[model samples]
Target: KIFEGNGAIAVKLFPSNVNVTTTLALASGKIPWVEIYADPLLNRNVHEIEVESEASKICIKVENLPHPDNPKTSYLAGLSVIQLLKQLSGGTNIVVGT
Candidate 1:
């Protein structure tokens, strides 16, 4: 969805050395309202989580760790969903086997 909306994909320090301030590096004023960007100084891999809403001019960013084995995959991709469902099912940390 993001790629389709932006019509461009900016990738850096991906599957390689992650250093310095990384970003989407999109064209000037490319994004209509808000654009998602990520540059983790410590995390070698990351996912630039961003949301856009023209109706309210809302842009949300939520970065997450990449797959333990592969930096390309998002760690929260599946774990987050599982965690949310667990929490909704009366699950708790340490006590309920979160």
Candidate 2:
């Protein structure tokens, strides 16, 4: 079954980074309505997700910190890219996680 209605949510965050929305799109397999905010008082990036489906209603919140070595990127995002590259290079016999 798939969600079959128009849904809306407001995504607010610092304009400097919006990768979380991209990540969420990938996870949910759909592009979501997004709104960005540049908050000077925030020391960390924040994301909130809300989903309403026939079977369930789900909400998620995440706070992210910049990579220690690279301030422009999230540490986990960088690692995920590297992990994908490793998988594509066929260096390992076992692949883990979706």
Candidate 3:
């Protein structure tokens, strides 16, 4: 089954699940249109994002595996946090992406 609603409402209801939307909003300085789906057929967490601007149009889709120790969390999310920490700590001078 799939459920659709406002991302703001979703943030309040499913804080952890919809956190990416919140991060997107903060990064873009705009509240993005969000669609939440509950599909039992999917084994991994999938996120799709579309952005259009006068300069360019962007589309991204990512499917992340669940953490081995925690099914509720995406493994990539934890890795991303670790990477951020390493960057912040000045461990590396090479920054790949913005």
Quantify all predictions' global Cα lDDT against the true fold: 0.43, 0.65, 0.83
lDDT of 3 by residue, 2-81 (tens): 44666677787778888888989899887767788888889899999888989999999989999998888999988998
lDDT tens digits, residue span 1-98, model 1? 22222223222212232211133323334433223345546473433434445655543445566778766656765586678878787776434355
Cα-based lDDT at residue 91, candidate 3:
95
Cα-lDDT of candidate 1: 0.43
At residue 3, candidate 2 shows an lDDT of 23
Best model per TM-score: 3
The TM-score ranking, best first, is: 3, 2, 1
User: Evaluated with lDDT, which candidate comes out highest?
Assistant: 3
**Predicted candidate 2 versus true structure: per-residue lDDT over 1-98, tens digit per residue:** 11222223332333345556666677898877664555778766676778889999999987778789986677777788888888888886554697
Off by over 4 Å in 2: 1-16, 23-31, 92-98
Clashing pairs in 2: none
Q: Who is ahead in TM-score, 1 or 2? A: 2
Error of 3 at 78 (Å): 1.7
Stretches of model 1 off by over 4 angstroms after superposition: 1-55, 80-98
* Model 3: residue 83 alpha-carbon error in angstroms: 2.5
* Ten contiguous residues minimizing lDDT sum, candidate 2: 1-10
Residue 73 accuracy (lDDT) in model 1 = 55
Error of 2 at 13 (Å): 13
